[model samples]
Target: MNLSMPIDAVTMLLMTQAIALVAALVLAAEWRLAKVRSLAWWSAGFATIVVGSGMSVLRTADSFLLYVWLANGLLVVAHLLFAKGAAAFAGRRLPGIWLGVLLVWVALLGTDPASDRTALFGLVNSALVAILSLKAASLLLSLRRTSEVRDAVRLGHIFLGHGIFYLAKSGLIFMPGLFVSLVGFKGLLIKASLYEGILVEVSLALLMLAAVRHRRERQITALAERDSLTGAYNRRAFEAKAAAGMALARRAGQPVALLLCDVDHFKAVNDGFGHATGDRLLSALAGILTDCVPADALVARLGGDEFAVLLFGLPPENLPALGRRICHRFAQSGAGVAGASLQVSTSIGAAASITGTEELPHLFDRADRALYDAKRKGRDRMSVESGVDLSVATPPLRLAKVARRA
Candidate 1:
């Protein structure tokens, strides 16, 4: 805890080694479960550092090879691995050519004169650690996302500060009146590094775990909210977003519109063409709806062969036109996804509510009734509940007999 006087340089090395080992183990365990590549890279970083620190602690009199060369080499590897993890987290990779050159340079460092090798290695290792840490921080800084921004930036700054500390250490060693002897200076520097390294290791562990947890949570959320077959919003996300959109529309004094879409003769398509073609038709239909709606609109797959589009800030009169657009586009596009012989069409039911007056559920009921009305009239057209238009055109009669009976 004493900043001016370290308890013991050897004790500090052992402590540093233990901290890195524990961090490595924790990251390795998480990597095993999550199977995240970045976690594995991070674990390798800590694991390498542990071995490097351990070599320094366990060095014998004849251990310049082990303590100076191999240990320092591993330390360089550790820094590079940490940088690699940062790049991986951001969906990137470090250049292999640059990494190869760095290792080659580390090999060349061993050619220093025997008397001056330790001093040379010390300075170079500090510089490499500083450079690698800063590189990792910069990589994290490049990611700007809503979900992971906080953790990414926090980790970036932490590594940034650690890098600056070592940069200062590497530069300050030769400054006058700081060290009485180079040997004493090296001892003190190791003690100082013990404190800094432990803190950095702990921070790295927590941030890594937190970032991974948050990322997985986002992935789970995406899976829950999306239709696997069509990539449209699932019913759950639709309802939630619809409510929010309705509220916004009311506040802005604009009407909210709902369009409920159904595939015409979808069962026949599935029966005749196999479910694969039918699925293609559905996906194509979803894409058509997505393309037809405004960017702000929400398109959802409500259930089997039933999809919904919710629009904000649109008048009731516009609903019929939007519905017709959806109906027409899918009619033209469906054959491309399946086959020219696979005839496909869509029936849309549309309703718009008085802004600041109608709730989403009430609007939903009106749209449902309109959808039933469309199914009764015939399939392959749109019906507007507010009566701007009862049908898009004379609908193709896929359900004419059933509609007449109804």
Candidate 2:
């Protein structure tokens, strides 16, 4: 298939410049501050220029004419790598064997001349493009299934744009010079490249926008789950975590404990020293709570001057010691009014999973009752409720009935 039509140097340069401009525009649109960045966006931008430049060079009768082929070959490799990056960023893993296959193809490209390997390499590359295109499509579908509309749109565009580009490129390689005589050499090939490059550029731009938007959404969600004053997980996050922990404990047939700790005289602290000092105290308490609990434990600010912890896989016998340790740590931290050495104390109520019927809210209620018992008995003491009163109650109903004899 000979492309006999006259394609002047000016026309070819115009086409290449157009492709470069499109790629640059999209690249700028997708620019972001991500940890690993979006590989698809970067690769698409790189391929646009690399392939366009290669095509441009191949047009000129210069010493670098052969180098242009090598450049395009490298661009193809970059395209594959970009696909892999896209899958990873989207939280999907591609098979390692695919990379091995691509490497073999690259080796074949190096050993085989363009005339000998063009058709075979094009076919192999097309197969690779098909795989990536399918993966992108599947990702988009999964996003839709999960109701990730923005992500779905972004990935769908990527799939559509790249699909078109690859199809056109594949056709161009497989049927080189087929339509060149009718329309011209630069006319057919350049048109195909330009169209494909434009689609790729637009898709990447939209995807980057989606990523930035998604990141912002996640940040907002995190903020929603955080306490405004102490920067700890709010009651909502705590409840959710508690429920999950209880479910896990049930599945594992293990014991789980819930702790409710309230700062003693917290209201007085706020009233006497103002909320500004109160807030600092709360922040300090938050830190102390975090330090006292296991790293994997879920700790949260349940409400005004109160915090909770859902300890999974904890033995019931350890509750008393753990509570004492927390109290000790809080005292050592000196979390109090006006930066002076202040003694801060908490009344802790602990409850353990007993019957399979125990739910998170029930556990919390038991803990809260125990906390009430602790305050009634006296502040600065730990109360454990396992259907028995750990501490004695006098005239004014100071003792809470534990679930069982502890």
Worst 10 residues of 1 by lDDT: 397-406
Q: Output the TM-score of candidate 2.
A: 0.53
Across 1-406, the per-residue lDDT of candidate 2 in tens digits comes to: 2334444544544555565555545545555334444544444545555554545445432422243344445445555555565565566766776566556555664553434444454555555665566565565556556535476456666765676666666666646553232112344554454445445655554565566568667878889999987878998888787677778778878788888887777766666556786688778878877887787788899788888888877788877777777766665444344544345566788888853338887887899988888887766667877534443221221111122222
The TM-scores of all predictions, comma-separated, are 0.84, 0.53
TM-score of 1: 0.84
Residue-level lDDT for 77 in candidate 2? 55
Residue 84, model 2, lDDT: 62
lDDT of 1 by residue, 60-107 (tens): 546666666677778778889989999999888888864863675467
Which regions of candidate 1 fall more than 4 Å away from where they truly are?
58-62, 101-105, 145-149, 171-173, 177-192, 248-254, 294-296, 314-321, 354-356, 373-379, 390-406
